[model samples]
Target: MFKEFKEFMMRGNVLDLAVGVVIGSAFTAIVTKVVEGLITPIVSLIVVLTTGKTS
Candidate 1:
């Protein structure tokens, strides 16, 4: 049972999956931050233009 487990972990597929998950998580965070940054400025500009007030 220990040998079987060891062999399974040693395979490339599991390692690749772990790497993919980590990279995907990082990519999601970066994209979310970038979108928020861009949207906030545009939305603020729109509000200021429409309301004629800067808050």
Candidate 2:
């Protein structure tokens, strides 16, 4: 039972899932930073220009 459990834990599919989770977390942080720091300000500026007030 221990050997079987170890094999299951070390399988390619399990490793792939771990790697995917890590990469997805990193990608979400990058996209969130870009949207907040760059896109949000630009959008706010455009909104102010069009409506005379910021959203």
Candidate 3:
């Protein structure tokens, strides 16, 4: 059982998964920043112009 576990950990799939997870995490952060910093403001401005606030 221990040897099987060790082999599973050493497989190429595990290594690829580790690399993918690291890259995905970085890409997610960049996308989150873009949405929050740039896209959200533009969307909010459009909504406000269309709605015409009463207050």
Candidate 4:
């Protein structure tokens, strides 16, 4: 059982999974920032204009 566990940990799939997880986390942060900093402002402006809110 110990040997099987060690083999599983050393496989290429495990390494690929680790890398994918790290990159996905980084990509999520970039997407979140773009949505918050750029897209949200545009949508808010549209909403305000449609609602005729001066403030």
lDDT of 2 by residue, 1-55 (tens): 9999999989999999999999999999999999999999999999999999854
Off by over 4 Å in 2: 1-3
For each candidate, what is the lDDT? 0.94, 0.95, 0.92, 0.95
Looking at model 2, residue 24 earns an lDDT score of: 100
lDDT of 3 by residue, 1-55 (tens): 9999999989999989999999999999999999999999888888889997533
- What lDDT tens digits, residue by residue, belong to model 4 across residues 1-55? 9999989989999989999999999999999999999999999899899998856
Give me the runs in candidate 3 sitting further than 4 Å from their true place: 1-10
Q: How far is candidate 2 from the true structure (C-alpha RMSD, Å)?
A: 1.4
TM-score: model 3 vs. ground truth: 0.69
* Backbone clashes counted, model 3: 0
lDDT score, residue 5, model 3?
Answer: 96
Candidate 1 residues 1-55, lDDT tens each? 9999989988999989989999999999999998799988899899999999899
TM-score quality measure for candidate 2? 0.82
Instruction: Judging by lDDT, tell me the better candidate of 1 and 3.
Output: 1
Candidate 2, after superposition: displacement of residue 4 in Å? 3.9
Reference-based TM-score of each model: 0.64, 0.82, 0.69, 0.75
RMSD of each: 2.6, 1.4, 3.0, 2.6
Cα deviation at 10, candidate 2, in Å, is: 1.7
Ranking by lDDT: 2, 4, 1, 3
Q: Which rank order by TM-score, best down to worst? A: 2, 4, 3, 1
How many clashes does the backbone of model 4 have?
Answer: 0
